[model samples]
Target chain A: MSHRSFVWLCLLPLAAVTVAFFLLPMARLVVTGAEGPQGLAGYLAILTEPRYRATLLNTVLLATATTIVTLIVATVAGMFLQRHRFPGRAILIAMLTFPLAFPGVVVGFMIILLAGRQGLIGDFSNRVLGEKLVFAYSIYGLFLGYLYFSIPRVILTIMAAVQKLDTGLEEAARSLGASPWAVQRDVVLPALAPAFVASGAIAFATAMGAFGTAFTLATNIDVLPMLIYTEFTLAANFSVSAALSVGLGIITWLILALARSFSGSAVAAAG
Target chain B: MSAQAGHGASVRIEACGKTFADGTRALEPATLEIARGETLVLLGPSGCGKTTMLRIIAGLELPDAGGRVLFDGKDMTAVPIERRNVGMVFQSYALFPNMSVSDNIGYGLKIRGVPEKERAARVAELVALTNISGLENRRIDQLSGGQRQRVALARAVAIRPGILLLDEPLTALDAALRDRLRGELNRLLRALGITTIYVTHDQSEAMELGDRVVVMQKGKIAQIGTPREIYFTPNSRFVAEFIGAANIVEAAIENGHLVLPGGRQPIDGDANISAAVAMIRPETIRVLAAESAPLSGVIDSVSFIGDRQRLVVSGVSNRSLTVDAPNTVRAKSGERIGLSISPDAVRLLPPER
Candidate 1:
């Protein structure tokens, strides 16, 4: 076969799988939400309802909070891992990345065991501080669970970026009479800005779309994912569920677009 | 220039050494002095601790043993790199990629809190001094190698540093560009009158640019002198061999004459030792016809160089000697040729200790 045909054959399976499992299902969901007997009324109802609105806002708020926290912690951790070489550096890196290997549900269960009301530190806080530390069923609880998984992903991405940076820039800044703090601010941070933005986007998208952890930890507060799950399984409203899913997808895409725009300038600056 | 001549700081180093944690001795105890407004070139082979010495002077690397780096009669041993006010041009031309050419040159001024208008004027002056005025808006990545080198030089001098350290700054350029820049750099440095220390493995560069050359080997200063002293009258066999291509022949002093395996010649200097290596320059060897030849050898090979022809002659004792003659002298391989050298051209270097 010709080279073009060979490449086409190699990509045929991925194309088939995407069409079969992803595009078809999404198209069907959108069509059903628009052309059903209610015919877009279900989407309107979900959008107009105060409960759904609150749930959407809460989901966005939680995703933003988780993203900022993950970015700050992961960037600092990545800088440490990249710059400082110590005896346990490799072990520390592997431990930070250990969450990526575990399924989201398993991570949720682990977080529950550590921070649930009856759990280890939760129980200790209750007894010692005379306050009940409840993290199982609130937005805060969902964020904690999401953080367990997202922080590691952010760290790995940012760490790779930091490692690839040219150390000569920092030395140049120092040689130019810049203080240590000034070197970090002007040279190192600007160099790492693109990676920071990219990793933040990934963290935010992952936190927003996380269902397994949210489902496992939901109690009184209902995020968008939980509401969609309830609408699909309990209320048997597939159309509404699909609409919520599409909304979440749009939000994530918008965030990713902003990230690309911001990081483009950063990459240019680095070059 | 007058101020520098009268009151500029001179660099004084005493007993400085550096040993890494891995026990690798990068620099042994070294002592030297650099006069104000004099350019000293540190020349050595690779891994000879030249770069390490430059770093120690720049305060980037500290010595492990006892040493004092006195600048302008002030002890600067404990000062950090930033406070030392020493500008360095690294081998890699470590320009900040995020900054434009003008900004890179002005960075030190900005860090020193020079006002914006003055910094801009100084940057413009340096850019013109380095002949890179049109490249002010160019980024480092967008510049050619020579342009980047000029930018680096401009940046180093923009701050008017007390001392300028260059770590093989011209080694990265093409040969043609390197030669051109060498003259330009000499002119610019002479005009600025900055105390500069240039490090390189190229001997010709050291000879051409330095007021004094410090030849190093194995973490020690082998010899330090003027270019003529180091090249023509080396103190030791290592210095002679390292500085230039000199033919070393073992000879003995007997009856007020130097006796070699092939010939006998009168000795010029006092010969206290029994045996020494006769250091002969290729240009000093004269190829004569067989009848009047002092030593006879068969020409192994002859090649035409740009200005002269070089002949590799193998003596009957199997000792090979190189001779440079005018291109007009035609000699072929396997031909018997006579070699003669004047006693004054024969330098007796001390035996390798």
Candidate 2:
């Protein structure tokens, strides 16, 4: 065969796998979304119905909050950990990243162990305040679980970026009469914008699509993933769940794209 | 320009030494003084602590306790780099990639809270001064290496700093660009007339730019003198070899003449010394007819350099002697030549430790 044909032959397996596993399933999901009595309006039901809209809003807000907080915590921690050398630093970093190996259900269980009704926080609060402050079964517990895993991913990327930072840039700033805070504001933070966008997108997408943590927390928690699971498995509402799934995917992708474009302009402006 | 004149601060570093946390001593306790509006070069090979001394002066790294840095007689030992108001240019240029050329140059002014209009005027003035006028709005990455160098220099000088420290500013560029920039930088420094400390390993750069050059070796200052002084009257073999090309001859002394294997070479030194280490600059030795001069050697190889021809002459001493002959003279390998060197041209150095 010619060179072009040989190149095409190499791509054949990837084409088969994508068509069989991804494209076909996606096309079926879209078609099945409109097979209900509401027809094409079944996709609109995700936005028009009060219950589905609230769950969608809750999921978006939780994911957004998780991403924002994770980025803040990780940037500070990563900068410190990457710059300073002290005893126990390696073990500290290893422990921080240990969450990456955990499944979402395990993260949820850990949160419950800390904040559940019979857990440590509740026990302490009951002894001190004469009240049991339990939040493990609520959306807060799922938020904590998402933060636990999201932090490790964001921190690792930030640390890598920090390691690659030209220390000369900071010194040059200082030589130019920039105080330490000014150096961070004017030099270090702007240089890390690209890493923030890349890692923050991963955190946001993970939080949006995660299900096992919400499932393990409580059935009543109104996140889109849990709503879709109940609507498909318990109520047997395949069309609605399929439409919700498509909506979730599109919204997460759109937000990430929006973030990328926004940071792109900022990076260019910085340059 | 008038305001900047005499604004240069005379720096006096008193016994500054640096020992790292790992117990590696980066610099020996060395004290030096730089006059106002003078350029002092710290020249040495890599890992020779030139950069460490520069950092000590820049306040980037603090010296050991009791090692004080003073600016114009005022002690500034505890002051940080930012508060010390010293301008610095790094080897990598370190131009902020996230900024435009004008913004990079004007960053110091902005940090000082210079108003927007004044900052813009200063940036534009520096843009014109550094010969990068049209590149003001362009990003740092858009500029070539030479342009980046000019921007880095402009940024360092924008704040009208009292002292300027440069650590191998031209080292990252190609050879041709480095030479061209060296002249340009020399002119810029003279124009500014600021107290400047430049660090570089290139001897030619140290010779051309420094009013005084401090030759360093193994974290200690080997010699500190003017270029001519360091070249003509080097205190030791290390300074002699590090600054420029030299042929070190080990010979016995008799009647104040160096008794070489080729012939007795006259030197200005104590006659009673039994042996001595002498340094003769390559250009100082002249090749003549073998029968006419006191010293004679056989030419092993002839290299025709553009300005002058270099001949590797054997049988002059224990080792070969590199002799620079005039380009107009035609001499081939295997020719016997006499070497004529003046007494004053031979510098008798103390024996190596």
Candidate 3:
């Protein structure tokens, strides 16, 4: 037939999949969110209710903190790894990115093995400081788990950006009387700003929606994903949990949209 | 502008050489001096130690132990590039993508703590000097290749450095643009009169811009002289062939004449040597009537270049000889032609390696 018709026919499968799996489910979630006893006000309860509001705030704060700390640690480590060559460098890089292969539950398990009661850190502190230090079940444990889950992706992105950097730019800066610190401040950091925004957005969204890590750590963590699970399965409060699901998805998507716009301007400025 | 001129310092590099960490010898130890307000060019093919020498002078690479670099008699071997007061134009131009054209030009001044008003005035002066006038606020990627080159030059010169090091600055542009910029850069360097060291493989650039050219080969300096001296009185076959197109003839000498397959050509050198190598430039060979000249050859091919036609004539020496005749001459392949040469034009070179 015609070329336009042929192209549309090729796209028919993708359209069918999107309607059946994505748009229909999203529409159902929105409708089911308003079907509770509180009616449409059940959606508002995610904010008006004191318990849901605290959980939402805790999740946002934890994700924000995780994103910031991951970007900092990844940028420094990636720059060092990209610039230097030594024995076992390839193995070291593989080991650094090994966490990407682990699921969230495994990350939570690893954090407990390092910082939980009867863990290595608790044992060391008990012997040295005369007090058993344990924090694996608190928000701090979840934060550590999220860091372990997010750092690998951010580090890979920052490393790729560092590799694309031109050595001549640094040399030119130094030739123009810029000190080492000044070169980094003016040239290197500005060139890598877009990478920071791009990878930081992924880390933030991942931390916001992560559930298994919180489940493995504790039941009282109060993160949005864990709260949604409790409301859906334990309390049998399906409408509130659906509303919270829609809220979490919208907030994550909104933050990512904001980050993409910021990165767009950053790329233009860098250019 | 004249007040800013003549601020160049004479540079002396004593036995400077570089051996990279991986044991690759990038440059052999060699000593050279550049006078104040003079432009010296290091001309060679790629991997010939030209860039390594320029880096040693720019403080980007350190020479091996026992080698020293001095600026106006002060030892500067320990000084870092940031404090060396040198301006460099890299092959990539290396303009800051995040900064405006004016900001790139004023970056060095800003680093030196120059006041905002003073930096702006200096930047504006450089903008006009480099003919990039109305592009002050434009970003680097917004400009064309030629504009980026101009901005790079202005940025390097805005600091009024004591020395300027350019490493193949115009090598990245198209041929037509490179020719135009080469002339402009020549004029700019003359006006500024800074002690400048340029590194390039383009001979025409070295001839037009350099006060003296250092021809390098295989991590060693092959020759160093004025462009005319290097062109006319090259000491080796490599220098002669590298500087321009030359016909190197290996022939036996008898009674001060070079024995050739086509004919015997007279030379000014001693006749005692059994065999010698001689160099003849293409343009120096004059085409003449086959019956009138002592040397003759049959034309193998003729290429009609705009100003001159190059004729590849076989049966002349051991190999075919290239002759650049005026474009007006009518010659074709398989035609018999005579070649005339002055005895003084034939340069006797040392035997090939």
Candidate 4:
């Protein structure tokens, strides 16, 4: 075979996979979104319909909060974890990253086990206050579940970034009359910005599309994934479910794109 | 050497030693005093504790207990680097890659709560002083190696530090750039006059930039003196071999002359010691035709370097002797050449350990 044709032939598997699993499903979903009783306006129900609109807003806010909180907690923990050494450091890092190996259903189960009616915190609060303080099966419970999985993803990225940081920059800042806080603000944080954007986007996208956790402990909360699940399974509304699925994917992808461009300046400056 | 262009703080470090957590001793208990507006260089090979000493002075690494650092007679050892008000430049330059050139230089001022307008003025002044003008808005990666070095210096000096600590600041540049920047850095350091402490392994850098050089070895201070003293009157065999090229000739002093294998070269020693280890600089020996001179050796090899030619002469000592002759002098390999020397040029040194 000629070299040019050989190179083109090498790409055939990737092209076939993309068309079979991605493009075909995506095109069918977009067409199904408009083939409903409401016609093309079915896509607008995600925005104009109060229940669908509330679920979208709820999911967006939860994902954004999860991303912000994950970045803050993981950055501090990751920096400390990467910089210090003591007994049990290896085990501690392993424990922190253990969530990455857990499925979403497992994380949701862990949250329920910690805060459910018979859980340790509820049992302790019942003894102390004469009333059980259970919050499982609620939005708070889902938030906790999302945090458990998101923290590990962001922490690993931040830890790697912190490990690769040029320590000379901190020394230079200190030698130039920067206080510890000033050094973190001027040198450390800016150096870690790209990692924050990259990993936070991943965490945000994951939270937006996470389904198993919502399925496990979701009764009182209204979210995009739970709504789409009910619409497809119980109500047998394939068109609306497909439309919501597209909305979810498009919204998550758009937010990630926005974050990427926001962080592009940081990467350029660091270059 | 004491031009005193800017405010120069007198620094004294006493009994400073560093023992890491892993039980490795980086520096032995050492004491040093740097004068106001003077540039003192710590000269040694890698792992010789010169950088450890500089860090102790800069407050990057604290000295062990009982060690004290004083600035102008006041103890400042407890103060951290930020509050100690010292400026430092590193081999990596360490300029902030996330900020513009002006912002990197002005960061210290901004941290101190200096007004933005005044911060800008100080940054501008330093930019002009370090000769990195018109590059304020440029990103760090956009800069060449030399420009990065200039920005590092400018950033360090923008705070108007009491002392400037530089650790191999020019070691990262190319040879030609290092040579050119050495002259520029020397001029800039002298102009700032901020009691600078420079650490480097290059002997030429030590000789050129240092008003007084501290020669260190294996975690201990070997010798501390003017560059001329260290060269012309090295107290130990290590210093003699470490700094510049030297032909160490071990021979006995008989009747106020050094008796050698080649011939009896002249000596100006008291002859108290029967055997002596001596250092003779290459440029001190003059070469001529073997028939007219007192001592002679065959030229082993001749390397024609610009401005001078270096000749390796055999059969003069146990090892081949390196002799640098003028470029104008005519010499060839395998030729027997007469050697001329003045007795005063020979420096007697302590025996090696």
The candidate that achieves the highest lDDT relative to the unseen native structure: 3
In candidate 4, stretches whose alpha carbon ends up further than 4 angstroms from where it belongs are A265-271, B3-6
What clash pairs does model 2 have? A270-B98
What alpha-carbon RMSD in Å does predicted model 3 have with respect to the real structure?
3.3
For B146-200, candidate 2 gives per-residue lDDT tens digits of 9999999999999999999999999999999999999999999988899999999
Report the Cα lDDT for residue A8, model 1.
100
Model 3 scores a C-alpha lDDT of 0.93
| lDDT of each residue in A1-271, candidate 4, tens digit only | 9999999999999999999999999999999999899999999999999999999999999999998999999999999999999899999989989998888889888888999877877999999999998887888889988999999888988999999999999999988888888889989999999999988888898899898888888644798989999999999999999999999989988887788898884221110
**DockQ of each two-chain model:** 0.65, 0.86, 0.80, 0.84
Cα lDDT, model 4, residue B318 = 68
The segments of candidate 3 whose C-alpha lies over 4 angstroms from its true place after superposition are A1-6, A265-271, B1-6, B269-272, B328-335
TM-score, second chain, candidate 3: 0.97
List the global CA lDDT of all models.
Answer: 0.83, 0.92, 0.93, 0.90
Task: Name the runs in model 2 displaced over 4 angstroms.
Answer: A262-271, B1-6
DockQ, Cα level, model 2? 0.86
lDDT of 3 at B252: 92
Kindly list the per-residue Cα lDDT of model 1 for residues B1-353, writing each as its tens digit: 22246223579988999888889998899999999988899999999999999988888888775887989889888888888888889889988888899999999999999999999999989888899878899988999999999999888888788898999999999999999999988888788787889999989889888889999998989999989889988888888888877787776788656676566666686777777777888888888896686777888999899799999888622368888988989899999988788878889876677
Per DockQ, the best of the predicted structures is 2
Could you give the C-alpha RMSD of every candidate to the true structure, in order shown? 3.4, 3.1, 3.3, 2.6
Docking class of 1: medium
